[model samples]
Structures are given as structure tokens and as C-alpha cells.
Target chain A: MRRQITGFSNPTVKHLRSLREKKHRKAAGQFMAEGLRLLTDALACGHVPQVLVMGEQRDPHPLLAKLEAAVERTGGEVIETSEEILSKITGKDNPQGVAGVFAEFDTSLAGIDRSAANIWLVAQALRDPGNLGTMLRTGDAVGAGGLILIDDCADPFSVEAVRASMGAVFTQKVAQASWGEFLPWLRSGAGQLVAASLRDAVPYRGAPYAAPCFVLVGNESRGLPEDYEAACDLRVTMPMKGRADSLNAAVAAAVLAYEVLDKVDS
Target chain B: MRRQITGFSNPTVKHLRSLREKKHRKAAGQFMAEGLRLLTDALACGHVPQVLVMGEQRDPHPLLAKLEAAVERTGGEVIETSEEILSKITGKDNPQGVAGVFAEFDTSLAGIDRSAANIWLVAQALRDPGNLGTMLRTGDAVGAGGLILIDDCADPFSVEAVRASMGAVFTQKVAQASWGEFLPWLRSGAGQLVAASLRDAVPYRGAPYAAPCFVLVGNESRGLPEDYEAACDLRVTMPMKGRADSLNAAVAAAVLAYEVLDKVDS
Candidate 1:
């Protein structure tokens, strides 16, 4: 059934706005996915959208029919809303005219036993949502065991990250935990730890990555915490040839992920 | 001298908004750079901002004084305006409340002769500004000879790309040319042409990167154009391990860039 929602004061719109906050996303165990391609990918992955919000200004994009078909199969709810309501929900100038609220996948590394050959990515306190998304994308592409988010990082489900990831967010298993919560896993004798740092680090490719190891990337501004840096067995750094001191966080992660993958494949 | 510009109608503010259009940016030969770090990097790179504008509500950022000093040394102009005016000029949120209008650097690869050892990135019709920016940043880090922009790509100078690049847009020498214009350089007999495709191509690492080769990255949706793909001597593909049929554009480019760099460095 299709219904029109015009007022920003509507309860459905209010609930959508709350999804933007991390606390709400966690408490509800759901995150909002915007843009047509992402929603379609989620449906393809067998994740059902609980609610579908359509912007009133758009007569429904060409991809809407595919989404509608998926909704029918999943037995989901469809809510049509005005452009003003979507703009407020997104907090942006342009609304893509479609959004889906999907139950967040329970991504936990708890069951997987660490091994000497398993590769993992440890993202420490990255603040940019887009960078985190890109990191997850690269991590998934290289078949990393899992992505471990430690400390104060951006919300992985923020619209920007989801968009930047280009559907990788749904496929990757990302486990978010505090340093204390993750300490036991880090100490697990399953793999070596390779910390990425500018100081006291050898060239990334020069470091031995044949062993199962976790690549630890630090915050956007401050490098990784001293404890994490000191705890690692290997410190690897990318060689900088230009005047720019460092590459973007996502770029650095990709280079490292590819290096690890290439080493394993060879 | 510091002056208060109260209204959007003010001459300076009007001129800044005009820059939102591509025609004005081209005619003035200037582009906008945002955030404190990027503006500072531009100054350090010896490119002065023609106009520096910031939000009036917030206290000056620490780098603002340094920017003022740099502007004074370079004989440039700085202006303070309300947050609303800044919002009007950038057409994007100004959370940092700092932005600068920089004179675009006119770089051409015309006179430089290509050798078999040159590592080049050819971006063919990329649509996302952030992806383009990240690609440019990665290209610079991996020591690509230069970035060659093909037809129908996103504007490298757009605010999103500039911010995503983290000032690499200025640091990397990028030359824009159409397919016909780029044909001569590709046929110069200096390097192998490797196109990245998802077809029956060799694994990227196994593919012989004989330097002086140009790595071709296709559009976000269509991949590379048929003509460009046909012109390539070798096609290399990154082996995928997951459900994702392809990788992010920037991530793909970074992987290829690193592989090429490793080949040359070794």
C-alpha cells in the first residue's frame, strides 16, 4: 500500500531522523541505507528493509520497481514521504528520493578462532565515516577475516560511509568493540600484529607478512595509541615520495590490504 | 585589514557564489579549497589564495593567523563573513567555517617526454568527486609520473574532490585531455598500455607492469570506454574473493598503483 506523508512533524519521519545517531542505531539494532544501489544490494544480500521511504518530489526512480518487488518478497513496509521530510532526515541538500531502514547485521568475530594464516584489519579511532567505509571495502575485497573497530571511531553506518563503500558495507563482517573488550582477541596467539605508524617503522613491503597478522591503522589526526603501537610485533610504513606527508586513511589501508593479499596469493 | 561583510548581496560574497558554476571557475582560472589543513597546505606549496573567507560566529582557527600571515606575505586578500554566506558560496556544509579561493595551477604534460619507466594513471570518466580525489592522492603517493584526466570525468577542482584529496589535487600534476587529445601520448611508443577490466584478464600482480605504462581506470558504472579498452595492449584484473563483483574505483586504482610502484622500485 502506498501512502503520502507531507508533514515533517510526522512520527515516521521523526523516527527516521533518530536513526542518524549511533545510540539509536545500536539500540534499535538497525541502520538506515540511502541511495538506490545500496538498497538494491541489501535486498540482493537477503537483508530485508523494515521500512521504505520515498521522497514525494520524485515519481519513483526506475530502480523503485526492483525495490518494490524485493519488498514484496521480504514482507516489508513501504512509507512514502515528502522531499522536505527526507531532506530533514538526511540533513542534506538533495535527497536521493529513496531510503531503506534495514536491521543491522550482527557482525561479531567471537566465533572465528584466530589462526596463524588469518588476515585481519584493526581500525583504531578513525573519525571519518567515508574512510571507515572505504577501509571495510578494501578489507572485504582482500578476504580479510574481519574488521575490528577499536576505540572512538565514526559510526560505520553513517550515510556517507555507506555511499562511499558502494555496497561493501553490507557484505563485510565488522565487529565494533572497545580496546578492553578486544584485548583478549589481540593477545590470542592466533596471529601476529602489524601496526602502521610513521615512527620506528620499516617500509610496508619490506616487513614480513607471510605470517597471519592484523594490520592496525590509527586515527585520522593522532597516530594509534601508544599502547597499541607498542603491543604490535611489526611496524610497517608506506614510503612517501611526494611532499605530502601521508596518504588518506582509506588509501593507506587499501595499499596495505593489497600488499597482504598479494603476499598470500603469491 | 579585517572587514565585516554582513549580506550575501555584498560584492565579494556574490563573486564567491559565482564560482560554484564551472564556467566561472574556468573563466577565473580559480577553484575553491576548504578546511584549515588544505588551505595551509596550499600556502606551503607556494600557491596563495586569492580570497580567504571564514564564518563570523566562531573564534578564528589556530591556522587562521598563519593564513593571514601567509596572505600578507603573498599580497592576497582575506575576508570574514557570516556562516550563512559561506553556506551560500560553497553549496556544502562548512563545519570548519574556513575556506579559500585558490588560483588553479595550469599544468600541462605536453613538453614532458614519456619513457618506458614512467608510471602513469589515466582516469577515464570517473564520476564521483571523492573517488577522483582519493585516486589523485593515491597516485601521488605511489609516485605516478602524472595523472591524465580523460573525457567526462568529475571536475577535479570541485570542493568535494579538493577536500577528499587533502591538497593532493594541487600537489599532483593533472592534465585534462579528451580521448583524441590523449591518443597521441598513448601512441608515443614509450610505455605499455594496461587497461583494468573485469574480463578474462591476467591477475594484476602477475601482469607485467613494464614502467612507462599507463594504467587505465574506467568510469564508475560503465568501466572504460570500448575504444579505450580496445586500444590497450594488456588488460589486468584484480582477482576478487568475495561476493562483490568489483572493487571501489579508488581502491582499485590504489591497488594497481601500488603494484606498478613495487615493480619499478624492485
Candidate 2:
């Protein structure tokens, strides 16, 4: 089905705009991603948007036509929206020409396959959407099975995070759980829980690493709880050679992910 | 001298607010940093603010008092302002209760000591302030001497970059030069220019990373100009095991920085 949304008061426009918020996204079980390139990536990854929104004046592209055909094949709705409406839907002065609305993925621990890859990234209390996105990108780069969000973390499906993920949002498996649930589940699996720490930590480089390693990082300001670090199978520390006390949470994860990949791949 | 700023129309308030924009900041050769901790770190690094603005309701802190004394000793001005004025100056709904305006540092290539550290970070055409900030933090973690901005990049002294840097903006030396100027200067020194590339590139792991390694990252989207990559003394490729074609620019730098650090330190 195809529709045209011309006014701000259109129900579909409101529905699409509401996906920008967490509560609305949760209630509807849907999230929005903008940009033709991003939507094409989603389509390539076997995710057909339930509703595709395109600016009326978007330039013609072969990939965009393929996307339209795929959406039609999947019995999806298509909306031609004005630039002003696109701006309103995205809350950006300069909106991407195309946006896609997809059903939010299964973000439960049960959805994850523990042994799918040699490395997995786990973050706790990560509040920054950009950091969550970066972790997804880092996870994709290292061939990690996915990213496991423990405790209170940013919404992985937020527009900011999705944009920052650079399409890794569709590529990476994202699951959310409380630390309590995560620890017990990890204990039941054949996985190594490792963290960058100072308490009884060996140097990160040349440190003992076991796969499939679950490389973990803590909050931006408070870091991981002492007992959490204590529970890790391995505690490795990266050197802080300057006045800055610690690395950014996502960078720490990237540095650790690469280390684990080097060891496991070798 | 200490004075009270009760209204938004005061020239001092206008001047403080003006520092937030790039043009005004450039004209004044000063930038602002907010919050007590950041200002405290700045003072610790021997960077006394030329202008200190505090909210009238701010809680008394010993460090803040020390900052006031230091600023006064250096013949600087201090302003006690209302929360409304503070909010207007900072453009944040909840003001940090304190903000400091410091003279911009020397950003010329001549100010850097190439022999001071084993690693240095260079970025070309990086547009995100947050990414620029992350590079600074990464450089600090690996004990890099500073960050050199090649070509047109985000303003390193921008408020967003400084905050994201976690005070590394003050810790790390910052220099700005065109690629034309940077190439000749680097050639005159004993430094290794390295980049993450796919052109006859070796795996990043165990690659030959020379001391004073300048780890360079290109734009967020456009990797690097072909000629630029050709000039790299070492071209290392990180394995991309998933659908993501590349890592986030800063994350790529972190992954490579650690690999280079690991090889050099060994």
C-alpha cells in the first residue's frame, strides 16, 4: 500500500515521530532509522521495513528502487512525505531523504547464541547512545557474536545510537538484561568474563585470554563494582600514561575486543 | 576583582555567552569549560582561567575557593551570577554552577615537541567534536604526546570536544596545520606515519610500529585521500569480520593505537 502524508496532524506522521521516544517505541514495538543508505543496509541484512518514509524530492537511485520493490514484496506500506514532514519526523533541521520503520528486534538474553563468535562485548550502565553505537561497531569489527547490555544502559535502538552504529545496529545482536540475570547466565555458559580493572589485574597485553571471551566494561564515571571485577575470570588493566584517569567506555571495549580477537584468532 | 552579574544584558554576560560560538571564540582567542571538576583539572594543569563565572547558589568547595584565589592572583576577573544568567551563558537548562573561560592554547605545529612521547595522534577532516575528543582521550591513554589536526577538522577547543576529551584537551598538545604544511614538518623529523589501510597492508597485529608513531585517521565517511595513504610509512589493516565495512574513526584509531602501543612497548 502507498500513502501520502502532507500535514503535521496526519496520524502516520505522529506515529512515526513518536518512535523517536523510548516509551512510544516500547509501546509500539517499533523504531525508526533515517537515511537511504541506512535503510538499504537494513534491507540487505534481511530486515524489510514495515513502513518506508521517503522525502518527496529525494534524488532517484537504483538502490532506493530496489528497496521500494523489496518493501512492496514484503506487503509493507510506503509514504511519500514532504521535506518539512521528514524534518518533523526526525527532529532534525536537515533530514535524510529516506527513513525506515522496522519492528524492534528480540532484545532478551534468550535470543543470544553464546558460542556464535569468539568474542562478545558487554557494557554496564552505559548512558551514552553514541558509546552504545560505537560498541556495536566495535563488536562488528572484531567478529563478536553480539553486544550484551547489562544493567541500566542506553537504548540501543534510539535514533542517535542507530545512526552512530553506522548500520551495525542491524548487523549486531543486541540483548538487554539486569546484571543479576547476566552473571548467572554467563556462569552457566562456557564463556570467559573479562574486564579492564586495577584490582589484581595483569597487563592487558599478553594477558591470559580464553574464548569465547565476554569482554566487559563498566559505567562512564563509576566503573564496575568491585565484586563484579572480582567475579571476572580474568582481570586485565591497560596502562594510563597521562593525567586522564581512564579510557572512554566504548574505547576501552574496542581496545579489549581487538586484544581478545588477536589472541583467539591466533 | 569579583563582581555580580544579575542580568543577561551585561556586557560580561554577553561576552561569556559569545565564547560558545566559534567565530566569537576565534575573535577573542578564548573558550569556556564548565563544571567544577573540569575547571579543577584545568587549574591542576597550570591553566588558570582568565575569567571565572560561578552561580550564586553554588555550594562551597575548597577547590573552587583555590581556583578563585589563583585566578585573582593572576589578575583575572571573577563573576558571581544568578542561575538564569548562568543558564543563558551555558545554553544548558541545568547549569553546572560554574564555568571558566581560558585563553586558547598555542595551536601551531612549532609548539609541539615531537620527541616528547612515543606516539602522537593525527586526524584529517574529522567533523565530529565528540570523535575529536575521543582521539584526545585515546592519545592520553597510550601516552601520546598530543593530537595534530591535519586539513579542516572540528575545533579542538570547542566546548563539546573539550568535555568529551575528559580533560585530555588540556593534557594533550593540539596543533592545526594543512596537509601541505604537515607533510614537510613530519618529513624533517624521525617519526613513523601509520594508517589503517587496505593497500598492500599487513595485519595490524605484530606490525612494525616505530617510536614516535603518528597514528592517523581519516574522515568519518571518506577513509582517506589515496595519496595520503600512499605516504604512510606503515599501512595496517584491521580485520573486519562482519557487515560493517569499517570501524568508527575514533574506534579504529583506538584499536590501531593499542596494537601499535603493544608492539612498540614490547
- Give the top-scoring candidate (DockQ): 2
lDDT of 2 at A41: 82
Please tell me which predicted candidate would have the highest lDDT against the true structure.
2
Model 2, native contacts kept: 0.87
Stretches of model 2 off by over 4 angstroms after superposition = none
Q: After superposition, how far is residue B78 of candidate 2 from its true place, in Å?
A: 1.7
Q: Summing lDDT over every window of 10 consecutive residues in candidate 2 chain A, give the lowest-scoring window.
A: A257-266
C-alpha TM-score for every candidate: 0.82, 0.96
TM-score values for chain B across all models: 0.88, 0.97
TM-scores of the candidates, chain A only: 0.86, 0.97
Per-residue CA lDDT of candidate 2, range B110-173, in tens? 9989999889999999999999999999998898999999999999988889878988888899
Per-model RMSD to reference: 4.5, 1.7
B86-151 in candidate 1: lDDT tens per residue?
888888764568888988776455834565236778888998888888877777677776677899
Q: How does each model score on lDDT?
A: 0.78, 0.91
Please name the candidate that would achieve the greatest TM-score relative to the true structure. 2
